[model samples]
Target: MTSTTTTGQERKAPGRPRNAQADEAILDAVLTLMAEGQSAAAVSIESVAAKAGVGKATIYRRWPNKEALLIDAVRSMKGPIPELAGVSARADLIAMVTANRSSRVQEFGKVTACLLPELMKDEQLRQMHHAVMEPRREVMREILRRGIASGELRADLNIELTLLMLSGPSMAQGLFGTETGVPLEEFPVVLVDALLRGAAA
Candidate 1:
């Protein structure tokens, strides 16, 4: 008899294939609810189950609680980190920034805007958010490190501060609707170029 196996905090019955369609439906339901302007508190497992057309047991089987489900939904919206070119930091950074702006910005912005207030009040949610974001941040950190090593960026470039500088504007625009008088499609190139002016060696 095949036993269960632990993967991270989740356990899976051996040889039991996950239903990708159900997972997508559940995650998409969460996004839909948030996009429809529901606050995090307003979204419950029951509502998500109804929207997703899956039983509440299905969600419970995957996530221990509503908060865990919400975090996973947000992670799904973030999608995957863009594959870097590894040619130069500038080009790679541009690709990273551009991918963020172009793909999931609107949906992610909606979810984050809806969830931000609750995220601030809940320690667990904040930790979950950080865990989800750290990998992307680490990618940026490595790019900045490589830039320094290759002499492509300033020798004294502060990686942490520079990471904030690179990510802040786009996030600000996404969350707060900050208008920069630049077309959204063009903003990534403009933003990266301007930052590099001061950051490049």
Candidate 2:
């Protein structure tokens, strides 16, 4: 696998002996800095090194550039999305969405909404964005799979497209931040219910 390396010479594979402590420091710094933007957040490499309390060399060793570093930082910040196991598709979707609506995951979502435009400018950042989000996508996929097995969803339903449909309300209205405009919780519930009715056997 390719990596963003600062030392041109290929010494060893990245993440081989990953330091959990340093990863935490970097991720914490990212959440704070991204939320702070250019204000309290320092864009300078020196500032990040100081804040992380790691040698500048260590930071450079892991990242190719500032954007690469920022991307990795955010990439490491993801956590498991909540799931309502052993439930109907309708119930699972509602429960999972409700969990995210009130959890820190929503904060990252808020962060993504604010940073995605800038992230799109850099190819590395875009990949990082995808890497960070891939797990969440899988989470939804798992939920759909469960729903299908339980006979709560259509046998021929397109999982990917259906996932998008499930997420429409959150994406359109900005579930937590409301920058995209607020959508009522009941609206998501109603929409999901309608979807269940349509997809049900």
Candidate 3:
């Protein structure tokens, strides 16, 4: 009765109306299992169904395979990109960084840490992860480009390297412990300021 859209096309499945509650339970079940240190390969459809309290047929009606289900679960957990203020590159970068760190710490931080190592090793899953991440990366790229064009950042700034510089440490802090001792509340300011010191026009 419900339809899902992909790539601008609506896909209607022949079944009863999709249950929103059931969908949430299934995705939450996947995150719970992953957070508990279960590898993607270890999470079977039956196990997910058992944990979600849905019949296997219910899951099958929603997802074609375990990988598809897992990807959807991860996507659900990722949430949307935070709306940028678009006032200044420095402010936008800080906002983006702050939201990312908060999301990692408050959202499914453990689930991500547990999944990344295993997921990155698989070509298909790696590609899927890239697909999910690329949009966010592009946003950052655009912000950096704007900064350079607007004379806020050095024209010679290497956007790719700057992107890594902006994101790498926050990601590391999320995966490992926050060794920087810069409280999460202050990290974005500290990070963006430091980068701007060298990068500012």
Candidate 4:
């Protein structure tokens, strides 16, 4: 039998549910600032609260600190992990690079670059950063392993070094100026072709 109050009305849960709309608004504010090219140093709880139309205490109740908030925002900003479909390693690599170069990822990279010094000093932030990147690294590692197994890559190739080689040019484009000799969109093809031809058994 269903339980009821002494007055014969149905009883309710103890507390009100958290407002989903408010949560979405707060997260959206953070993303909006990033999209607007606001540096991590420039993002503050007060600014986010004002943009989100919520009190500063509301944000604190949800996130312990600004670093935690940024971690959550950046995690959501990533591109989809590249799928390896037994296609040619070179093709899959190109797909991965293309996905990583999406606008969101580039924006997040800029945010991260702005916060790099703080992230290096803070243990918790460093852990969060590693957690965000681990899956992408594993996917790249798997693709390289598949290439090795298929004899498409050299048997003695160091997967770690190869990952760096594949990604370095694009990363360099971001770190250095965009004038990387080759245009940004052409980087994946050029780097992948060079690696495959040189590294092929």
Clashing pairs in 3: none
Model 2, position 32: C-alpha lDDT score = 63
Relative to the true structure, candidate 3 reaches a TM of 0.76
**What's model 4's overall lDDT?**
0.70
Pairing residues by index, what is the TM-score of model 1? Answer: 0.78
Error of 1 at 174 (Å): 2.3
Clashing pairs for model 1 are none
lDDT of 1 at 81: 71
Q: Rank the candidates by TM-score, best first.
A: 1, 3, 4, 2
TM-score of candidate 4 relative to the true fold: 0.70
Q: Cα deviation of 103 in candidate 4 (Å)?
A: 0.9
lDDT of 4 by residue, 99-144 (tens): 6676655554555455556666889777766766676777788888
Residue 10 local lDDT, model 2: 20
Model 2 regions lying over 4 Å from their true place? 1-18, 39-42, 81-108, 154-162, 165-201
The better-scoring model by lDDT among 2 and 4 is 4
Tens-digit lDDT track of model 3 for 1-201:
122224112223334345777887888898888777788889989999999999999999878778767666666654357788888999989877775665534456767767777788879767776776677778889999999899999999999999899878766776776688777689999999998986556
Question: How many Å off is the CA of 120 in candidate 4?
Answer: 2.3
Which window of 10 residues has the lowest lDDT sum in candidate 2? 4-13
